[model samples]
Target: MPWRDRISELPECLITKILSYLPTKHSVKTSVLSTRWKNLWLTVPSLLLNCHDFPYRQDEVILSFLDRLLEFDPDSRLLKVKVECGGSEDIDGLRDRISTVIQRGPQHLDVESFTEYRDDDDDNFLYPFIDYIPLSLYTSRTLVSLTLTYSGLQDPGLVYMPCLKSMTLVKVHFLHAADLEKLVSGCPALEDLTLIRNMNPIYADEKVMRVRSRSLKRFRVPFSHGKRCRSSVKYTLEIDAPVLERMTLGEDHYDIIMVKNLTSLFTVDLGIKFVVEFGVFFYPGDLPKRNEIRYFLSGISSVKHMIISDKTVKAFELYSNVGMIPKFNNLSRLEAVFPFKLLQFLPAFLECCPNLKHLILEVYYSREMEDAFELTDVPQCFLSTLECVQLKRIHEWEEEEMKVATYFLENAAVLKKLTLSLTNYPRYVSDEEIFEEVNKVTKRSPACHILPDWGLCE
Candidate 1:
């Protein structure tokens, strides 16, 4: 083939489009392809960099490459900038350089640094662009989304971003919760916010900070702190967002007062710690008790879909008054782990949520059952609107298990499918025995399938 013909056959625009998805390093290498490709990377709309992508000693080379790319088209509208680097010294230098670049103000910035090693004297070894966030960059009105994952971040004051919409902070240490509250309040149009960290003591002078976003739609705050620290501090969230639709409460230090006024919520996920005795303590408390478990669930009266962790299910029985379980007239989906003893609450739940169409039971045993045929309290009537039943971990078809299956088959008039998970099979009950019992118990299902590994069911 003639060289001219080969060149003519190639589409320069198509080649540039393909190179746009490659990392900045690989994209720059395209310059060596031909003179026509020398400036191809400069026109690329996205840039991503990580210290691990290239040799550790090549920091200068990486920095020079980024500088040349930015210089090539200083006016270009960058859509994304991702920088992930490690090592304390590399991070400190990188932080300074990144701070300078951020001052230029890209529309989107995602910066993460993970280096746990410290100097021999116990002082933190700072890496490039790791310790401090470029405060000047937060003031940029052009930023639409920003995510930062670092070790310790002190208070970031009332930094305003008129056009900012989404913000995510992970492993950030705030000097005061008010600083975080101030940052959220300053984003006039912020819509999404996520915070994941352990508990820190609230400042003495800091008032309970309330977040008020007129355009906010989703909020998630997961606590990864262990039991020791969580039990001591009370974390409170004050939200005044009329447009809020989805909320996820995670971690142990969260305050129960935040959800009381969220009148427009549609979906809620509560990650409450399950302790039977702890739950019983709040059964007779005030209208909206201080109990973290009950207070979180009671606020979402209008939710259409609800997810409660296994811990929350075990704790529900602690409340002597079943009436505390909020009504969800519009609820259609419910996912929860069921304690064997809590099986009795199924009937009451069905009565409350008449429109529920799906029920997912993640059965967790208290201990190994010695007598497989022991009967437990199983709901007698099947939910009329239930169309599908999913049972996880069906090793043994004890009398209680058979009674539960038979009740559902007899009462679920509109039921269409039943799924059984045979995880850890034969070890608990022989497959032959479980299959025979299921065949005898199930009556109105159109299809029934057994999955040895429940993870594959989805």
Candidate 2:
């Protein structure tokens, strides 16, 4: 590559296009480069501002910048507007300024309000202030995507948006479920919605928020473990999107969830923690049978692809023990991450997925499996459907682990690729010995490729 300043001779429109990708501050700074670039900043289609750009709560700089930016052109159509609210005490005054920009018909709006002023060393911004959004922003027909992350956001009453297709609300508080419902009803074209740490008032009788949109295609309810609600009332999430294709849920223990329709769902990823009875000890009676379980199992059974953590696998153990797991006729690709305790259910889960073709098992060997499962027969899928198998996090010199690995390698009739990657250094034996033991198992098909990557030992 030759270093050349010829790039500067490109057409003004092409230069503006490149400048649009830079931050608003950088775009403005480009004006000093040359006379031709002086006025080009005004044509930049996006404005991204963080409160750190101005001294905390200093309104003069922000106001002057906005005034100049807004006055640059009344007809200028903004492609994106993103602002992080920090150190502003006058909530209404800030809303008016933000409203001035959003009213310009921006296609995307991202409003993030920080609770505390963070120094340059810290990347995390704590949630503090509630941003009262101007009502006009929600009514914009030109807005296609909106993300609001404010701690105590009041409802932007009477949303009339029609062209909006995607919305995300993080830590945005609402007065009631009706407020959220009103927003959903107004967006007739909404296809995707993600709610992260959103707080909507739940009545005594109705504890959960409900989103029922015919056009909704993707839905996510990602909750962090750190999120806490002081209220004693239990809240559940209910979604009624018949056309939804992708769903992701939970990084914490969820109350109850009712997904009304998932007939079109294809993929699901969950870092799930179910609300089972808590105790310092474990007992067989603690397990809830399938009928007793307010089963989320049935709702996601129709998915073709899934990634579930060890917590999820353990949560399903009670049902698997009693053979209550529903047959996953539609599921094909599956990834199961197992903790020490959840390893027993690996074979049991395979039995339920008769059509699974791609399998990835990630084991976290952190404890002894006192109650390991004794598999008598290979799963039906291993003989007929399973084609690819990836065994990740396998520790060295474990007899039971080798048995399970050999069982799959020996019996998988239609297997094409088998990957075995060691999780740690060998305890008492070498990786070569583990390979020999695995080779002792009969290869049902000679074409199957067995790969042993023991890089951890080296």
**Best candidate, TM-score:** 2
After superposition on all CA atoms, how large is the RMSD of candidate 1?
Answer: 5.5
Q: lDDT tens digits, residues 139-240, model 2?
A: 898999999886444466778789999999886666565567678778999999988744333234435668888888888877553445323555566777
Q: Which regions in candidate 2 have their CA more than 4 angstroms from the true location?
A: 1-8, 114-129, 151-157, 199-206, 226-233, 276-294, 319-323, 367-373, 423-433, 443-447, 452-458
The TM-scores of all predictions, comma-separated, are 0.75, 0.83
Deviating ranges (above 4 Å) for candidate 1: 1-16, 52-54, 57-65, 90-96, 103-105, 114-130, 151-162, 198-211, 222-234, 253-257, 274-292, 320-323, 348-355, 370-388, 411-458
Q: Compose the digit string of candidate 1's lDDT tens values, residues 1-458.
A: 65574642568667656766788789878788778878887887667787677766477777776677668767766677888764454433566667656666678888876535345546565322326666676577788898887634556665789888898887654556677777787888898988764344323433354577777889887656545434344556676777789988664444444555667788878776532232333444544553554555566767888787766655455553643666677778888777776666666655666678877777655455443432333332243567777776665566666666666666676777666666653366776777666766553444443333344333
Question: CA lDDT of each candidate?
Answer: 0.65, 0.72
After TM-score superposition, what is the CA distance of residue 20 in candidate 1 from its true location, in Å? 3.2
Locate the minimum summed-lDDT window of 10 residues in model 1.
372-381
